[model samples]
Target: MSVKIRLQRHGKKQKPFYWIVAADARSKRDGKYLEKLGTYNPNTNPATIDLNLDQAVQWLHNGAQPTDTAKAILSYKGALLKHHLDGGVRKGALTQEQADAKLAKWLEEKAGKVDTKKEGLSKAQEVAKAKALKAEKEANDKRAAAAVEAAKVEEEVAVEETPEVAAEETPEVVAEVAVEETPEVALEETVAEVAPEETPAAEETSEETEA
Candidate 1:
């Protein structure tokens, strides 16, 4: 039976995880496998993968056909590269020691690149957080300033209304003073008229007595 290298689905819905496996070509996608290779988790920032490089190279040597995704995974983890190096060793084109050295150097460089990517992501997150905080502070400041302005407007309105109330009461005070002065003027006029009538009556009495 022909063998195939493929991924077997696992993990929860919507967050798919997988296991790399070498299995009979006729088996169901997630069924029995000849060997468990490694795991692939796509839920991480830079999709995490763990592979048994030696075992994977051995499978490739034995002519296991890998699916496209499986081939990419093997390539990423350097299994394909190791397989090629082993082929060159078998052909006497490269020594085993040389192959191992090259693979190790490549793996080291790949690790450094991954680390640099992680650092860039971390710095980007910090910048985003700082920007969000600054925006929130600015929004709060605007609200505080608006509240102060509203309070000042209310105070000015109250002050303006105070003068209008005082002006309304001024007419009543003037009316009271006018009423008090009118009564005094009327009494003086009445006293002057009565004195004139009494003087006229005394003159008539004197004339009659003289006659």
Candidate 2:
């Protein structure tokens, strides 16, 4: 029976967690497994992985084929490297002490790289947050300036309209004064013409009475 080292899917939709296991290749993906190796959680920053290193190495030595993703996990957790070093030792390519020293050195370098990547990610997040806040503040300031400009325009319009209204009222007042003066002037002219005719008629009547 062909045994495969692979991941079994679990957790809810959009949020996934998995179990790394060795199972028969013909078995259902989430069905019975031969051995539970570890767990993998992709939700975290660095993608959390927990593994039983000795069990994983034993399984690999037993010819359990790992899927591509599972292989990457094994490599990341140093299982694949450890197995390679052991093979090198068995083949007389290197001493066990030398292999262990090499692995230790590689792990130290890998840890340093991981730490640098995490620091870069954190700095990038802070910059993005600051940029977002600055953009929001700038937008608010622009809106406030636009509001002030609109209010100033409204005030200027009101100021200009008040003078026009005052000008219109002045013309109406002048027209009213002219209308009142015209009627009084016409009455004075009529009284003066009638008084002259009355004086002429009285003088003619007195002469006829005396004759």
Best by lDDT: 1
Report every candidate's CA lDDT. 0.96, 0.95
lDDT of 1 by residue, 1-211 (tens): 8999999999999999999999999999989999999999999978899999989999999999999999999999999999999999999999999999999999999999999998998999999999999999999999999999999999999999999989999998899998999899999999998998899899999999999
Scanning candidate 2 in windows of ten residues, the lowest lDDT window is 105-114
- TM-scores, in order shown? 0.75, 0.78
lDDT of 2 by residue, 70-165 (tens): 999999988999999999999999999999999899888878988998999999999999999999999999999999999999999999999999
Q: Which residue runs of candidate 2 sit more than 4 Å off their true CA positions?
A: 173-211
Give stretches of model 1 more than 4 Å off.
165-211
Q: For every model in order, what is the number of clashing pairs?
A: 0, 0
TM-score of 1: 0.75
